[model samples]
Target: MNNEVNGDGPDSCGIRILGETRDLTVVNNRIGNAPKGQQHIGILIGEKSDRIELRENELSGNLDRKIEDRREEKLWPVQIRR
Candidate 1:
């Protein structure tokens, strides 16, 4: 199966994390195939969010991908592996 997201603006990503969310893991998934004219992302970690883990995942065929800590503070660690 193909994972798709057809939309614009914030939270219109294949994976999204926001607020004070932390200690989370996103692993072993196939994320792709966004609509032709939309703002889609491979992964997104929003403002004030931290400690996110993205491991052994495949991200392709998308629009925009801004994957990281949006905030300047990180108490733990974020891991992204393939």
Candidate 2:
């Protein structure tokens, strides 16, 4: 596992992986502008986790509008069930 997270506060979240288990590798990090209360996820994989690999990371300006109004009122109608 390799990790490097550069920050620009506002409750920075360059990486957040939760639960379960698997092979993991996250490389080359530069995540920016991630704050808007609670869970600010530049990378948050938490649906009972699985094999994970995020490489060559360079995520910029999370475009925080209170995190898009709390992810449009809690991730509404967005279906992408693995």
Candidate 3:
């Protein structure tokens, strides 16, 4: 699935949960490789949310690399909530 996700929600992001939710879990899957020129995100949990359980998932190669970029990414693979 190129930029497509199978989550239990109406608006389909890779996985976007909101509000005073807690204890999220992402497990057992290989999420990688964006169709050239795309920022393939493996996952994202909101900052307000807490106690994320990430286990036994093969997540790799989700990045957007290009030349002439001004702001260098301080973090590799991905960046999470501030």
Which candidate wins on TM-score? 1
Provide the overall lDDT of each model, using Cα atoms, as 2-decimal numbers: 0.68, 0.47, 0.43
Per-candidate Cα RMSD to the true structure, in Å, reads: 2.4, 12.3, 9.2
lDDT tens digits, residue span 30-49, model 2: 65553434334566555555
For model 1, residues 29-56, the per-residue Cα lDDT tens digits are 8776546445456677777777788898
Instruction: Give the poorly placed runs of model 2, Cα more than 4 Å off.
Output: 1-31, 34-39, 59-82
Ten-residue stretch with the least lDDT total in model 1: 1-10
Q: By lDDT, is 2 or 3 better?
A: 2
lDDT of 3 by residue, 1-82 (tens): 3545444332223444455445566666656544433433445554355555556665555333211112233222222222
Report the CA-based lDDT of candidate 2 relative to the real structure: 0.47
Kindly provide the TM-score of model 2 when superposed on the true structure, using C-alpha atoms: 0.28
* Higher-scoring candidate on lDDT, 1 or 3: 1
Residue runs of model 3 more than 4 Å from their true location after superposition: 1-13, 64-82
Question: After aligning candidate 1 to the native by TM-score, how far in Å is the CA of 1 from where it should be?
Answer: 6.6
